[model samples]
Target: MAGQRRILVIGATGTAGRQVVAQSLKAGAEVRAAARDPGTAGLPDGAEVVRVDLADPDGLRAPLDGVEAVFLLWPFATAEGMPAILDAVAARARRVVYLSSAAVRDHERRIERMIERSGLEWTFLRPHAFAANALRWAGRIRAEAVVREPYGAAAMPPLHERDLAAVAVRALTGDGHDGATYELTGPETLTQAEQATVIGEVIGRPVRWEEISPQAARRRMLDRGWPPEAVDGVLRAQAEMVTEPAAATPTVEEVTGAPARTFRAWVTDHADRFRAP
Candidate 1:
């Protein structure tokens, strides 16, 4: 609705970051995609690609120049390097929208504070269980039509990355969202077992969620190359979620002018991933 300005996407190749880039372009913002390796980012044409490794804070300087807004996606597990990184971004960008977790773990909270004090116009998007997270089950389903994990009864409101990106784009381009902290979730709550059923329905098979011990789940995640602490956190969250299901919210529709997508839609969009190779 106003003059377009360059918006920098920090994790341009990621699930949500890719949508941010694409949606920003649709929203009429000039997009600058930043990644550790711009050569392999594979972002759509018309994006001005640049290299900025968050591990090296000073490296962000060049890529962030002339950026009017930033979609801050933290790909790291810790905030040890974020102070310097935020400094580099704040020096150039007038606006920033952070892709934060609803879990609000310690490191993320610390980074949130820094952004609040950074003097840039900011908004925080805290999204719950990502629907695309079911991609983890894609491999297992493709091979055996079964998903083995703890907390099969644990419920989640899995928000689509596209919905998250739509809200982020609105915050980046439009007005009145400044100082807002949006809690985003999908349109409905579905348990882990139900999610498996939905996947099965989408793929024309009987997908089953087999309950396993927490220790076995932890071991499996560790074997999948997940860091130890993050694995523990995932199991811990799922364990806690058994009694308290994740709640859906209307924030996505309020901001994006469209309701948050359901897990069925996400599974439909990514059904090919579950197809046997």
Candidate 2:
């Protein structure tokens, strides 16, 4: 809240984390962007990039030093080492804003509880599916102009990383956001199939969505080195979304004082990722 408050951003190399680092710098906060490899984190010029492994909380002391606030993104699949990490964080930073998933799984809840008990002010951002997740289809779109996945009819309000980051920066620097859980989403809901079509429209191609069996998807994900439990969890969530479509939320606009960006806007912003090389 004062002149150039020091902000440390965990998971700075990730999709939403990258935006948070950039936006926090734009807000004139002195940002220390922490990642596993600070040398190649590629954060903005104003940030001070540092190496930190969340699994090894001892390395967090340097990054947390003189950091008034933190934007945390839990990169692990489990909450095994979170308590120690929070302990390190609480020793230095007064506030922490965690990027949580909208699904709100048990592991995430456990982490939240740990943050709550750490005696630090905190805000949890529970964003719906990220629009950037569609980048997983980039390879297929570039090669075949097709996205092959199950649950083509599963409608989800994909939240833009920028909007999520904007709300995050506010919580990191502003007041009255402590102990808040913001359910952030984009302006509209689109089925997976429709999202594919929108990408095609943005990039001037006919991108198609080919529905595959969930078993096939599960196999493919596991082969790609995803954890078996995470693969199964993703598949189960998608299957549930088919009948129970996710809707858009107004929290993004409420917090940032601007309408949440649309899925089309997100596609347009990152059109080159889907374009043929």
Candidate 3:
């Protein structure tokens, strides 16, 4: 933490990346926020926002110049241009902290192989369901005091975006985290219904959860303009969760030296969004 290292953050405008940029700046790191359009990135003050399209990383070579560490968040479903991007980053950067998913756990070797071949110091963050997923129900709850979704009994230990950001900052700036893969989650498990209840409590209203068939939910998502594959993926994931035990881990606390935020706390913090006008 002596000299200011230029840290390149992909998806800097996203929920987690925004926090990463802010936390990195707070930690005295020089942040270079990379997005498709720098003008629209709206990053925190003091960040040098740059345009870098992951779909076509050919012209993105300039952004990696003088960059020491990279915060890579794959915004695409497939790893198409990742090799080129990683090659560019590895050519200049000494370390990379990748924002991965819990799905990576079941496919670790594949991802690890790709990262290891990059020849850069790497840290992988495999975060479970994000508490921000509640935002999907925000519209329904605000309008009708009801959240309709499939799998009310599906349990998830949703990790807060802030906690994930803290861990990413540690990995990006601190030592002893290279080659580590951390599974981050909230401190407690809550079903979809329980999460709705928490939101209701925070908003001081009597919100209710209404379960729908998976097919119905799929149709609803498709009608809302979600890609067909994405709709199917969500329904399949939820169906699997209904019968499987929720995945929970303490890597967030272990890495950041603080406990993970709770679901109720997250809802409480965002209560205004769910409140009825």
Candidate 4:
């Protein structure tokens, strides 16, 4: 195990975080998958699951000990407690790769600035829409093979989680990535309706895109316990995408030396989730 890189994955249970853990272990890194509840994290065998809660920055010290790089996925909507968290990370780790959004929302910008000032080598991954967002339709797809939402024409270059993790692992273990902000996206642009069709094709059924009014969609989301502001933000973004579609980026391939996976490939990988029980 000479020269084994030690990495700490802060959001080890999320979609992208899970992929980062797996891929880092595959690349021969000694990975510590940090979660609030390590016993329930269910990460792969090689990962040393450690208990660490970002909300309670004090808990990070033990997990960050002896770790050289950290892959951070800040789960908070605001930048509260970020300085303390970065302080703890910089105290132990020299490098941090943050999973940031391409939207560069206010909170994301604030956290990025804090990481820069923390004096640790840093990389920001600004990924476009995640292909896993399609999982939001899993229940309806399983029961009725239909997706009901507004702005069926909204177009995005959905990124595969594995691609995002690949870029992250490269930044975590390799050099020449410090101060880099990678704009990550999939290979092609697909409309919401087209994404539904791709899912249907992969699952061997015709899944229909039942377009609803933005108002109705907003109501439904609120009824499902979504914050009013979050619901509004989602609808507004989708509406904008209807007119101005998101563009695909070559950064994924440029960083990982592999072409970004298509939405079809993502669906094929998770087709069983959309199929009947």
Candidate 5:
């Protein structure tokens, strides 16, 4: 941690990974943005752009060479190829800060076991619903002023991507974060309907929420080219959380020393995406 560290960021073009790259660069870490196609990753200035295909482990070795730390994002649904991937990273990197999900807490020991077996310094960030999830309703809000979805009353404490990235940067470059699992969430819990209403208020529109059946919602997602498995996962997760007590956490503030941005703030930042042409 004393000398200049080289950090590799996988999925560098993604919503969260982009922020990770930006924050890491701002922190003065020598950053490498890794993606399948380096040509279009659009990495921040001063960061080296490299091509690393996750599907082909042989090709990944070169890009990871001499890297001190890695920001691993599991784009695959299941951790099927994780063993080989973690082994590869552990071979070169001293630390790994993984972008994980809150669902991992339900089976905490299993995930921790896997990371521990990797024999590398590790930090797991288990974040709840993302503020960017609201972007899913952008098309509807732009057209009809009504966001239709199932489980309208299901509440989630949505953490902003920037907040998550800030924590990742700290864990990657700082000490005392190894082997830590941080559960990140927004400052407050709001239902899906309430989130839509907040977006409307931020955009200065009268956007309303229309509840639909889970089956219908699944069909709609499928029609829009979402895979069946993903559709099922979304509906099942929403239905299970509908009447359950929402889980809120202060991990963002604890890790970043700043309050997590509200959903309203996220809306204001991305209001242009929902603006009428």
Candidate 6:
């Protein structure tokens, strides 16, 4: 059982990492939740919480000790100090499950290569747009009841954070997932406008999407602290999606033995976030 293995969960407070921590605990794994601040990590009582900064390769070594498996979450845009970090992980950990972007950005691919050659059993999970990304509209939706953004036609099968974590737990605790790259998606492909409508339905409000210029959207993203390159990459991905629709996959169900949930279900689960308060 996973109870014998000590799993080191990086980014333990983040979207997918939080779920991994909870599920690993449920599966009886000895979880060492690593965060920059242990007190504020807000993990369960059973966990061995520690301070770890991924940006600092020197400080990363201590956490790898006695860790049988690792749930990696790359929080940076570039692979700076990643080699040293991966080398440290390779020296100790038996396996690693990296949470990567479906876009397969340069940095993600770099980490993938390092892990493959690191001699540790590895699994890559590339998830599509996050359903929680809808929170970006929460403020606007609560105020204006409208989502004003560019690429309203962009189609995406937004995956739920919990579903993504379920697969990570399987790969970490169960066997046969090594060297596998899983492309994950939600149950439906909804356009940006359609997603707005779904939110409106679940929140019992009349919300609509208004198309804006890409330039305006870039400004908004920049104002929110997104770098220029990231903003460009995001808009480019959406622009391509406008014509090429995303498709749902059964990977989450197949791996976790549960059907991938629908966008409507996600909205319902997080309805309080969208509720007018």
Per lDDT, the best of the predicted structures is: 4
lDDT of 4 by residue, 1-277 (tens): 3226899998999999999999999999999999888889999999999988777888888888899999999998899989999999999999999999998989999999999899999999999999999999999999999999999999999999999999999999888899999999999999999999999999899999999999999989999999998899899999999999999989999998899999999999999999989
Q: What is the C-alpha lDDT of each candidate?
A: 0.90, 0.91, 0.86, 0.94, 0.85, 0.90
Per-residue lDDT of 84-139 in model 1, one digit per residue for the tens?
88888888888899988999999899999999999999999999999998998998
Q: Model 4 scores what on Cα lDDT?
A: 0.94
TM of each candidate vs. truth: 0.97, 0.97, 0.95, 0.98, 0.94, 0.96
Q: Lowest summed lDDT over 10 consecutive residues: which window, candidate 6?
A: 1-10
Q: Tell me how far the alpha carbon of residue 55 in candidate 6 is from the true structure, in angstroms, after superposition.
A: 3.1
Off by over 4 Å in 4: 1-3
**Which model, 2 or 5, shows the larger TM-score?**
2
lDDT of 3 by residue, 150-244 (tens): 99988899888999999999999888998899989999988889999999988889889998998888888889999998788777777788889
> How far does residue 36 in candidate 1 sit from its true spot (Å)?
1.3
Candidate 5 lDDT over 1-277, as tens digits, reads 5225789999889999999999998888999999888888778898999988887777779889889999988787666667787788888888988887887633344545777888899999888899999998998899998988889989888888999999999998888899899999888999999999898888888889998888888888889999897788778788777888468898888887998898888888899888776
- lDDT string, candidate 2, 127-240, tens digits: 989999999999999999999999999989998899999999999988889999999999898999999999999999999999999999999999999989899988888888
Segments in model 3 whose C-alpha atoms lie over 4 Å from true places:
105-111
- Tell me the spans in candidate 2 whose CA falls farther than 4 Å from its real position: none
Position 85, candidate 1: lDDT? 82
Q: Which candidate should be chosen as best, given TM-score against the real structure?
A: 4
What lDDT would candidate 6 get against the real structure? 0.90
Lowest lDDT 10-residue stretch of candidate 3: 104-113
Lowest lDDT 10-residue stretch of candidate 4: 1-10
Q: Show how many residue pairs clash in every candidate, following the order shown.
A: 0, 0, 0, 0, 0, 0
Q: TM-score for model 6?
A: 0.96
User: After superposition, which runs of candidate 6 have C-alpha atoms over 4 Å from their true positions?
Assistant: 2-4
Indicate the TM-score of model 3: 0.95
